[model samples]
Target: MLGPASVQDLGRVGQYRFGVGTSGAMDDIALRAGNILLGNDENAAGVEIAFAPFKLRFNADAAFALTGADGGAELNGRLLPPWWRACAHAGDILVLKAMSRGARSYLTVAGGIDVPLVLGSRSTQLRGEFGGFHGRALQPGDILPCDRSESPDDAGELGAEPADIALRQRTLASGARRIRVIIAGEYDRYDEAARQLFWHTDWRVTPQSNRYGYRLEGPPVQPIVPIEKRSHGIVPGVIQIPPNGQPIIQLRDAQTSGGYPKFATVVEADLWRIGQAGLGSRLRFEPISHQEALAAQAEVSVYLERLRASVRLQGEL
Candidate 1:
């Protein structure tokens, strides 16, 4: 979602507002990390992919960073660092090719890209047709004007920038409950098999996954139980199981309210990891205690703050 391009949201950081479409990153943490690297606004324009590699050409010299899926990003055949800001010369061709780690990758540029704001948000809301470049994906030849009005000095140095994630990186974790879920809506309607299968089995991501939700392939996740609750608000990470037993894992651009029952939700911290899980990437759920989940969330926050601080200090040099 693109906002007025005024860099206002960067200054107004309190009070989480909810629109027709929810605000926040599908992988909020990773996006923040990218912003820190570029020393740009946290809502800067970057490429978001659903396990598909994105290729773009830079028309000018600028700093950029890729902070999400380890989707191999290369500049003119040379690998670029993930989660570190660097300069891209004029006419540089940046490629975010597919990686097996996660699904989406966010590429932030220095000075941030200027985009129009809609409905008090700057995120892409495909369903509502409000934010982003004309509320749609970037097409070849699309020009994303930059905010020439820049941030103060020390805005772009957030870390020891890198050039790449090592090739052949392995699974994110070995735990079964690493993919935590929270039940929502008609969860009780599904049969025991459906819930057990959903919780215990390994599912493959379909090529059809996109910003809305990841469509998985496995036992159709039916409401193991029958429907009883009314439709309510849903957020990214809530897994909504339809009547056929197929689960739709919500993402950033999901609808405001859904009638479908969500058997679980991926933890906010680990959601980005799941996004990097490319198509055909296998997934297994690992349930964790609420306290443990909270602890992990706290840890991620501290880590992010530390990353920001490190970058801030580096900028001083």
Candidate 2:
């Protein structure tokens, strides 16, 4: 049978036209751990479960791991935890439940998910609806074929967590409780109180958050006086404050330009956290020196080393 991170039904997602992207690991940190457990590459394509559990009947017995965002996974009525990699017997049912800690979870199989690599990756960009599982969510009766490539047989349960990332990107740094920002264009448009509120107040992640941007709902932190300035190119992590004063942080899939006035930007290292935070996650920003931001990146490199250490690669059978 096949394994995790293996993009099944390659070119299937791209053919569907599901807005241009298909689903991969919502939290890649979790997925990479699963791959390492299976002795596979981090890009190994698997079904990225969002808000629901994952269920797949293997054509053959294989080894796999479930990492991150506990959704009450059970194998033939036996409950399990995240960061677990074990061998599932043929016909044994592996079931994942709704989220308990994180919003999404990753399932990696041995030998990797054996989908034809399109454009060098099997990640389903569901927005583009290209690549991975017919460019859509895993559907029932979808027969995922296994690759002939054999994986190591590591008999154990262990892995590192996604929150373990030590890097504080220049683009997305946070302090567990507070988000940070780097002032950008249109910063001068706001008055003193507006600036204070923008930097010093707590905000709520609105239901409108997505890959395109994070819409933070908080007190109005807009310009006390209006300014007529042309729109400029927008980048991921830029906080675009409109007349309403609420800020929207753009993400990887965000558009290139916008007309709204932007005040600040989220640092780089911590940007991935936004994906992990989900729609209802409470958020607030903090200000940091540029040197601190770079230092955070160094910290991130260390954390990654620790995570790599925890990976239990499968032994040669």
Candidate 3:
């Protein structure tokens, strides 16, 4: 019931088989962090807000956590920080300022949003218009039902541990963004010069970038010889090169398959970086071995486990 633009439920995972796009949160790490703060399932439904000077009036008391984007959240006129959790009484107004960093923010309420799950997920597939809050972005006067009963007493006021706050700051800090890629599919088709250019050149995200894919603007990457490839199954993170020589990084809402030549696939651990990268952001690619990719994922798992353990311990306090 608030925003300056584009809000949707953070993606539907595990339902892509029905030709549905996995339209979840762009910054999954933030979504998981907020849910953990509120003791909700890491994948529990939450709102993904983009480009916001967002405001919402709560009609009921609730515990909520705000994560992603340093939007300068305020509850009842009191300033709040990202990764912070707090309580809101009935009629309290929550205001989130425009994004200062990162492209999206997540609002995870305790007990999660009480929307009917379709195919085991509550994410909105904007293209298909199903699932999520009436299959659309929330509007003013729209009443969203939440599972208030599922909220635990300690969910609010816990805030973020000093360590957690530091972690978020470090991850979202501005700098030359390096995204790791595990080489896959048709990578050999490109000539040596193009391959070197891919790794060494800085690519700028064009305005065409969206949840569907990021169309990058940089030096053209051309294959040594013309090749025609049939469309095959593809998933998020695959870098496809079209005839125009521009690179397109398929995202959560990407089509299931494409005829474009696939050069490289971003590792799962680094997709969140892409999600937070806005138009005009500079990105560089780093090649990693398959083992390195697996290790990266393992590191993420350990970090999540620590978050879970910390929340559990706090609940017992």
Candidate 4:
């Protein structure tokens, strides 16, 4: 493992109210797609690989899917394409080389990784260390157990169209990915110029970015007048502007509360795009109405449903 690799599902929902943050797969769509391909539960736990050059050996006959980044994976030396699924025999080695696109890759088996649910989720809480496999990342010699009861018996090699292709989004002329956002409570605190800067600038994802949040590099987005507010509840996708003026996008493992000035929020539908964005990537923000955001979310739902139906049809054949 080159970077953090941990077991994650869709994440704990209701428990977040109890001070536990949701720590699920960053590229949730990828993970869900992998599970769907293998006929596993949509929220089945899978190994989320943040970085590449990862290798694993199956101890038993099984099927698996590789989704998210195209990391040049090879199953026992046979190259596999991104979003592809295939079966493996005992002792088969799966190796993932460097990623060519996106930031993370998900390895989902025929059955989800067998890990005890903590706070109703198997996702790793790196800070709390209470969930996932020991609530930590996978290290060498770490063997993961899988619940193979749901493994499909007649699954042949299957491939899925990547999310980027299946759900295309508009991009800025500068080639920066355009992420849709909705204005937040403190949007009016910033002057028109600051708002324009936030909208027009191609923010660069800094090295400080992680699952906790993404620290963007760009012209400062300071408010018109200094203002202080009490810390309030926050969630993934909330964009907060700190004293230094840089924007921080709270993500999957972000804290439950923060005091930073709210700017805008990346819609849930596009959170996967942010998750897949590699370090140093440029992203442009496009402000949209709340209704538009909901529409975008509906579009994603439709895509997933179509994929699920198609996979089920294939299995029936």
Candidate 5:
């Protein structure tokens, strides 16, 4: 079941120069976690549901997992836990209520969505309108075909594990979301004061924000003098300071190249915070060295490894 204003396959990666964005799940960790719990490939195509209430009915017995923002998921009127895997019987209904904490949630079925891959991925590039469940958000009465090899029976009476056997990712607190960044490209060209402001000021994600980029509201950050530049390659994490001074944090669906003055890039590991954050979400940036950035990423990898271990242990129990 697809719900909300922004639902897409996380997005096709590696085809950016062709003007395609890596539009996969905004919170990839959540997507990966759901896949892992259901014993699917981490990159398997799954539903990236934004803030919307939706319902899905199982045509057959299936094993599924919910991860990412706590969406108040209910299966046939019973509340389900986040970041855990469970099985649903034929005729069972799953409903996702409006989210209270995170902006997006991921739902992965046991065999994955089984959507045809476009450009080597099942991600839906909404702008281009290709890939994933007929290349758009699911509508009422639309049926999703699943790979049947891993049905609940095949997995043996499936259900969520005990809390000790399940590993959950860090939860975002209500209010300002703290984000870490690394100063990138043309950092010195900006005046000392402008650079300081970038780090010191608390920014607000405007309502205009979306998968493309987050348009921020804060003090204007201008450089010492106008610098000439040409459009060059850009990535999801690159923070571009436009003429208005408010920085736009490029996200998964951002264009491949931009000419704006590069300010700071959010490190890879912390990008999920932005992904989970909704409009009006508060943001504060803290600078860290290159070494520290790598360490943080490694820590995230360790967390995923631990989650896998926990799942294996549950099987034994």
Candidate 6:
């Protein structure tokens, strides 16, 4: 076992008021797609594998799906393509090698992982250690329970086009991933040079980046004057600029509140892209209006709906 492998669903909601951060799969699109393939709830709990060389043995026959970053998965030595789904018999072993593309992968079963829900979600809260399977990452000898309400025989081999390809969003000409952001309250506080540097330069994701936040490196983006403010409520995707000038985009596991200078917030629709960004990868930010952000979210919704429809048709056939 390698990386922080843990059970996660869509995320914990309606609990931020209590200071609980939403801890969920970084690449929610992958998790949702896997669940959809297995005829499970879109938010069904699945294993989020951040790193590779992961090995698991099926104690019973069950259906499973592999989605997200291509992990080069294999079942009993048979290679499985990314976003592929199939059945596994008792004693069958699934192995995921080092990821060839994205940063995370999801392994979802027919009925999702059977972990107790805390605060209305089954996602692992690593900081709080109160949810998910023991609220921690799976170890070598750990045994996970799966809700096998659906039979393994029901689902044969199936696959879907990866979200990136199927959705087909706009990209940057320079080839760097283009992430859309909405200018936050502190945007104007930065001088012209700092603001221009932020928009023009491609920010490299640093090795220190994690689910809590992505620390970016690029030209320093200093503000016109030193400013201090009270810690305020924050959500995933809020971009903060510290004294170092490098930006840190808060993510799924970010704290409920922060006091850093907010430069911008990556629209929710584009947060998944940041989740899949690999270490040392460069990202270019494109500022969009609030209306455009909503449109982007609608596009995601349409994509998921189309996927659901396709899966339903396959089931009827």
What TM-score would each prediction reach against the true structure? 0.80, 0.77, 0.91, 0.98, 0.90, 0.97
Q: Highest lDDT among the candidates is held by which one? A: 4
lDDT score of model 2? 0.63
lDDT score, residue 60, model 2?
74
- Regions more than 4 Å wrong, model 4: 1-3
Which of 2 and 4 is the better model by lDDT?
4
Every candidate's CA RMSD: 5.1, 6.1, 3.1, 1.3, 3.5, 1.5
Residue 274, candidate 3: Cα error in Å is: 0.9
**Which candidate order results from sorting by lDDT in descending order?**
4, 6, 3, 5, 2, 1
Candidate 3: where is the Cα deviation over 4 Å? 1-14, 161-174
Error of 2 at 263 (Å): 3.0
lDDT of each: 0.62, 0.63, 0.78, 0.90, 0.77, 0.89
| lDDT (C-alpha) at residue 275 in model 4 | 88
Question: For candidate 3, lDDT tens digit of each residue in 1-317?
Answer: 11223334556666556677777777777788888899887878888777667788888889999887777889999999777889998999999877767777788898888888887678876677777787776676667778888876645576654222433323323455788998878998888889999988788889888878999998888888866888778889999888788899998778877788989999988888788787888788889999999988787777778878888898888
lDDT of 4 by residue, 49-117 (tens): 888789999999999999998989999999999999999999999999888778899999987999998
* Residue 199 in model 4: lDDT: 94
How much lDDT does candidate 5 score?
0.77
Better of 3 and 4 by lDDT: 4
Tens digit per residue, CA lDDT, model 2, 180-282: 6677767777788878887666677777776567788878886857655675666567788777777888764465567788787777656655656666666
TM-score of model number 4: 0.98
Better TM-score candidate (1, 5): 5
Q: Candidate 2 — which residues are off by over 4 angstroms?
A: 1-25, 145-148, 161-176, 224-235, 312-317
Off by over 4 Å in 5: 1-11, 152-175
Q: Taking the tens digit of each residue's C-alpha lDDT, what string does model 5 give over 158-235?
A: 333322123233434544666888998888989889988988777888888877789999999998887668988888
